[model samples]
Target: MSNEPDQQSETTTKTNKPSIINVAVAVIHHKDKYLLGFRNAAQHQGNLYEFVGGKIEPNEHAEQALIREVAEETGILLNDNTIVKLGRLHHDYGDKQVSLQVYKIELTVEQYEQHKYCEKGLEGQALTWVSKSQLLAGEYHLPAANKTILEWLKLPSTIVITYPLTHFEAQSNPKGAWLKYHQEKLASDSWVYIRLKDSDSESVAEQLMKDRPDILVILPNDNEQYLDDKHFSTTGDTKTTQQVVAKHLTHSTLIQLFDEIGSSTASIQSLPKDYPLIVSCHDIASIKAANQLAKARLNHNLPPIIGAFLSPVLATQTHPDTPPLGWKAWADLAELADMPIIGLGGLSPTMAEKVIMYGGIGVAGIRQFHQ
Candidate 1:
């Protein structure tokens, strides 16, 4: 995690009382130049160039607020289709904490200046198209505004989709039906599973190339009786799934799975340095798994280990146990596992919010269908 403090924390943590409702800003751009405006007031006035946006009202959504603010300040009518939610920033400004839902809008330079010099200029004094590189050079007036712009530049352009790899088949009766259903629901970037057959562990690499293609697959020990490996083979499958995956999907997207810490550590040792691994744990086994892997220093070499299915309260025939811990447990476990964690198990978009709030990478769901 970056050591820099979140700007929203300054405003949010100052007073014990709950802060006002959310506000936001949109970084409108054209080519390499950004649209910046000078605040007319004293608090952030005097040549201060900031992204055009402001406080969201009682009944307004963040996106709606952004549109209204932009138009109100610069007389530019922004359509809903022009907006894209990049991410959010939470900052504390001494007395109040503000959650800034950041967005990006692309518009032509001519359109921008038309609004800037419009007869109905409402709030800002001037508007200028500044190159992103120029903004990075620290010529901006407001320090916080500069920081926000810099942070936006650092964020990835595409939203990263992190998913879990589970042991499932496309032909195992009810299980197969469920697997196929979920597989179809997966986002293009989401992770999927591939079980290695017992007969030819060596051919696992070849099979992956032919069937699953670029998906990250879980290779379990073949035990014939253990639920995970009942259908797959475990003997002489010494080459880690990560190794096999690395060989086939070198430049493609693929993440391997390690059921327990012992296997994870061993797999890390056997696989290439760059092969991604998904560390899984469900039940008491996770404690030993994480501890052993950490002890072996395998966690140090591998990429972030996404948390697999974990439920604090197990569902029973009679009734459900406690409510799901959501990302709290996953966050805690990820800290111990020494890797970034993505919440799995029964999760929804609402649950995913909690996962991100608690410092998780993202959320993956089996029951939820992808649009």
Candidate 2:
């Protein structure tokens, strides 16, 4: 597949191939639809769909390149401030390697109303606004490199990390308060990371999974409880029966896995492929480790790393003694990550936009989510 949809000719190969081509991609959103362009059969990865964007110029930053490309191809001038970072993706087609600097632009209502019906591209391509559901369902065929980006696009901007069950039970209506509160707090199609540390957390997770099949519930990777014989049993209410539970690994568990596996590329496959994995990264080292693990799994065509949680972006009451990473430090570390980074700790749903602006794909928190 071709990296540039607008280029009419095949790319010339240099004697020494460059490491990778850096492309700027814009996921222009207006309400529930995203602006897309159809590449002609003559073009590379031709006759398929693509987001509106092009190659980054020598001195141009990703945002600048995206804005220029979008304007050139669609005749829509984009404000630089409106571009929000959506992390990056690196993929290899054997013939070509590309690193996509993906960004998101939420169009104003006026812009959408004016251009929503436009089907003709300013360039020689067909422009269309595809619904998010259509994209997720694979109705529009995108390039192979866009697989992970599309998956990331499906994620909600805010994820609720549940407080321990005990905390919820302490309330007046202990019998059914926690489930009711969670049901109310979580909107349809939202995500919740269950963090209960008690013995019954698995049973509680099973209930949540059954009740809210519309939502995604991620369980912590507790070996003692989730790895025992019952977890993999064929019958009964095992995590595997209803659905394989996605796992969230703490920084320590991630570190341990990385160390135990060493550099054997095949060892990465030891991590279960039946479920998605999310790793918590508190520092640059942990981020690097998580990236390594993700790269290894990608080589094996395993389930992609859902995301990495980078915490303490801001100080909170629970951990006052530990200084917050602040936005600058958090962004620096986040840039090093291969998977989408979710900014956690001292963050609220309201701050999700800011988190994306600072290089995170989403936001996660306990008390803030509870509120």
* Each prediction's whole-model lDDT (CA): 0.46, 0.75
Give the lowest summed-lDDT range of ten residues in model 2: 1-10
In the range 1-371, model 1's lDDT, one tens digit per residue, is: 00112234433534456464476677777767777766544442344567777787788887788888877777667873355444454444444445656666777667755653343346425667678778767677653523543533532211212222223333455343434544455455334443333343333333432343444444332222121322224543332343232111110111232253334455545433443334445433463454344334322534222233333322322225545554456555544432334455555545655655554445544334254
* Model 2 pairs whose backbones collide: 2-44, 2-45
Best by TM-score: 2
Q: Which stretches of candidate 2 lie over 4 Å from their true place?
A: 1-19, 166-188, 222-245, 257-262
lDDT of 2 by residue, 299-368 (tens): 6777778789898899987789988999999999998888788999898889988988888888988887
